[model samples]
Target: MRVIAVWSIKGGVGKTTAAVNLAALAAREGARALLWDLDPQGGASFLLRVSPRRKASPRRLARRSVELRRMVRATDVPNLDLLPSDLTYRTLELELNARKSPSRRLAVKLTPLDGHYDWVVLDCAPSVTLVSEAVLHAADDLLVPVIPSALSLRTLEQTRRFIAQTRSKAVRVLPFLSMVDRRRRLHREGCERFAGGAEGFLRTIVPMSSIVERAAEARLPLFAVAPSSRATRAFASLWQEVREQSASPTD
Candidate 1:
C-alpha cells in the first residue's frame, strides 16, 4: 500500500477532511483505499458513519492480524473502508515501547494487507505523540494542509523539522493551502506565496467554500456531494498531482 499520512501540528486546519476526500477520490478511481483513523477524536469515523469504539488494546492489535482486520469496517462508499479508533489508542505509545522499534509499529500492522489496498490514508491527530511519530516514520508521503494564515505557519515549520529529524519514509512533503478565502487579503497572499515556494508543493488551494461545510454537515466526501464545486476541482487536481508524482523516481 502507498501509505499517506495527513497531518498538521495545529488543529482545525482540515487535515482529516483532506484525508477523507483524498481517500474517497482514490476509491472513485477504482483503487482500493483504506482510511485509518489515527486521531483520538474520531472525526474520520464520524464522517464515514462508523463508530470509533475499540475493545482491543494496542498490544492486541500488534499481535493479531485477524483481530485487527475484524476491527476494520467497510464504509458506505464502495472500495473505501475504515479502521476505526477509540480513546484506548491514547496509550498506544506506551504499548509500542515494548517492541524493538516503536516508530515502525503502525507500519508492521499494515504489512499483512500489502496488496489489499492501493492507497492507505492515515488521519493523524494534531500532536507530536508516539503514534503520530510512528505514522510519519511509516508513511510513504506526508500531506500537510495549512490554513492560509500567519499563525498556521509556525505549525507548518514544526511539522517540517520533525519530518526532517525522523528522516521519514516520506520521500516528499506535499504542502497545500486549505480553507482559503480569496476575499481575504491574507488568504490570497498566503496562497500566492506557497504556490511560488516549491515544485514538489502544489499550487491548487482548497478554497474556503460553504460547499466544504455542507459536505461535513452531510458526512460525505466533497466530490460525492458537490462535484461541481471549486473545492471538488481542487481536490481532484491534488489527487492527480499525487498520482503523477508517485510515479516519479525518488532520490
Candidate 2:
C-alpha cells in the first residue's frame, strides 16, 4: 500500500482536514483506503465519528503485541477504514524509544496491511519526535499543508532539512498552500510567490472557507456535506494531483 502522511511541524494548518478528505476521496474512487489517526487529540477520529474499541497503548503497539488489523474499524464511508487513536498515544515516543530500531517499527507494523489496502493516510500530530521520525520512515509520500505566510514557508524549509537529516531518500515531500484567504494581501502574495511549482510545491490551493469548518462540525468529509464548495473542489484537485504523482515512477 502507498502510505501518505498528512503532517507538519506546526499545528492548525489543516493537516487533519486534508487527511480526512483525501482518504474519503480515495475511497470514493474505489481504492481500499485506511485512515490512521496518529494524533493524540483524535481530530481525524472525531471528524470521522469513530472511537477506538480500547485504549491504544503505546507499549503494546511498540512491542508488536497488538495486531493492527484487529484494531481496524470500518467507517460509515464505504471502502474506508479507520485506525482510531486515543490519549494513550501521547506516550508513544517513550514506548518507541525503549525499543530497538524504533524508527522502523511503524513500517514493520504496516507490512501486514499491504495486501488489504491500496492507500493508507496517516493523520499525524504536529511535532518533531520519535513518532514523527517513525512516520518519515514509513511513509512513501509526506503531504505537508503550508499556510500562506512567511513563517509557514520557513517551517516547510525546516521540514525539508529535517527529512534531509534523516536521509530518507525514498519519501517524497509534497507541500501545498492551505487555508488561504485570497482577499488578504499577504496571503495572495505568498500564494503567488510559492505556489508556482517551486521546491516541489503543489499547484492546488485550499482556500479558507466556513464550509470546511462546517464539515468538521458536522463530522463528515467536505465532499459529503458540500461537494460543490470551493474548499471541496480544491481538495478534489489536490487528490487528483496526489493520485497522478503516486502512479508516476519515482526518481
Candidate 3:
C-alpha cells in the first residue's frame, strides 16, 4: 500500500482540501483509500462529513487492548474510509516525544490498517513539530502544496532541508502549486519560472476557484459534486500523476 501525506509547513495552502479530493479520487479509481486525519483541527474529517471523536493519545493507544484497525469508519463515498481525529491529538507531540522511537510510533500503529487500504492519505498539521515528524515517518511519500509566491517557496526550501536533515526514508517528496491564479502577473510569472526550472515535478497545477470552497461548504469531494469543473479536471490530472509516481519502482 502507498501512504501519501498531504502536508505543508505553511497553513491555508489547501493541504486538507487536496487530501480530501485526492483520496476521494483514488477511491473512485478503484483503490481502497483511507483519509487519516492527523491534523488536530480535523478539517479532513469535517470535509469527509465524518464527525470528530476524541481518540486516545499515542500513549493511550499503545496501552489499549483494541487495535487501531477497529477504529476505521466508512465515508458516504464507496471505498473511502476515514480515521477521525479529535482535539486530544493536539497533545500528540508531547506523548510521542516521551517514546523511545517517537518518529516511528505512528507507522507502527498503522501497520494493521495497511491491509485494509490501498492508499492512506494523511492530512498533516501545519507544523514541523514532533507530531508532524511522526506523521512524516509513517508516510511513504510527502505531497506539499505551495502557493505560487516567494514566501511559499521559502517554506518549500525549509521542507526540503528538513527532509534532507532527517534523511527520511520517505521515497518521494512532490511539491505542487495550490490555489494558482493565472490572472495575476506574479502567479503567471511564478508558473513560467517554475515551469522552466522545476524539473522532476508534476505539471498539473491547482487553479484558484470558488468550487474548492464550495466543496468545503458542501462537505463533499469536488469530483463527486462537480465532475466537469476545472477543479475536478485538475484533481483528476493530479491523481493520474500520483498513480504514476506510486507505480514507479522506489530506491
Candidate 4:
C-alpha cells in the first residue's frame, strides 16, 4: 500500500477534510483506499459514517492480524473503507512507545494489508507526540494542510523539523494551502509568498467555503456532497497533484 498521512501540528487547518476527500477521490479512481482515523477525536471516522471503535491495545493488536482486520469498517462509498479511531487512542504515546522499534509499530501492524489496498491514508491527530513519530515512520508521504497565515508557516516548519528528527521512512512532506480567502490580502499574499519559494507547495488552493464545513455535517467528502463547488474542484486538482507526486521520488 502507498501509505499517506494527512497531518499537521495545528488543528482546524482542514487535515481531516483533506484526508476524507482525498481517500474518496482515490476510491472513485477504482482503487482500494483505506482511511485510518488516527485522531482521538474521531472526526474523520464520523465524516465517513464509521462509528468509533473500542481501543485496540497496540501490543495485542499488533500481534493478532485477525483482530486488526476486524477493526476495519466499510463506508457507504465503494472502494473506500475506514479504520475508525478509538477513544483510548489519546494514550497512544504510552501504548506505542512500549513496543520494540516503537516508532514503526504502526507500519508493522499495517503490513498485512499491503496486498488488500492500493492506498492507505491516515487521518492524524494534531500533536507532536510519540504517536506523531509513529505516523512519520508509517507513512510514505505526509500530506499537510496549511492555512495561509504567518503562524501556520511556523507550525509547518515545526512539523518539518519533527519529521526530519524521527523518520524511519523516506516520507515526502507535501504541504498545501487550505482555507484560502482571496478577498483578504493576508491570505492571498501568504499563498503567493509560499508558492514562490516552496518547492513542494501544491498549486491548488482550497478556499474557505461553507460547503466544506457542511461536509462534516452531511457526513461526506467535499467532492461527493458538492461536486459543483469551487472547493471541490480545488480538491480534485490537489488530488491530481498528489497522485502524480506520489509516484515520483520524495524530496
How would you encode candidate 4's per-residue C-alpha lDDT over 23-77 as one tens digit per residue? 9999998999999988889888788888745545444554434455677888998
Better structure of 1 and 4 per lDDT: 4
List the candidates' TM-scores in order. 0.93, 0.97, 0.94, 0.94
Output candidate 4 Cα RMSD.
Answer: 1.8
Model 3 lowest lDDT segment of ten = 56-65
Number of the predicted model whose lDDT against the real structure is largest: 2
- Number of clashes recorded per candidate: 0, 0, 0, 0
Give one digit per residue, the lDDT tens place, for model 3 in 5-112. 988899999899999999999999889999888888989988888864445344565432447765678899899989878776787788777777878787888888
lDDT of 2 by residue, 66-185 (tens): 788887899999999999887878988999899898999898899989999999999999999889999999999999999988789889989998999987648889999999999999
Candidate 1's error at 39, in angstroms? 0.5
**CA lDDT of every candidate:** 0.83, 0.91, 0.83, 0.85
**Of models 1 and 2, which has the larger TM-score?**
2
Q: How far is 190's C-alpha from truth in model 2 (Å)? A: 1.7
Error of 2 at 247 (Å): 1.3
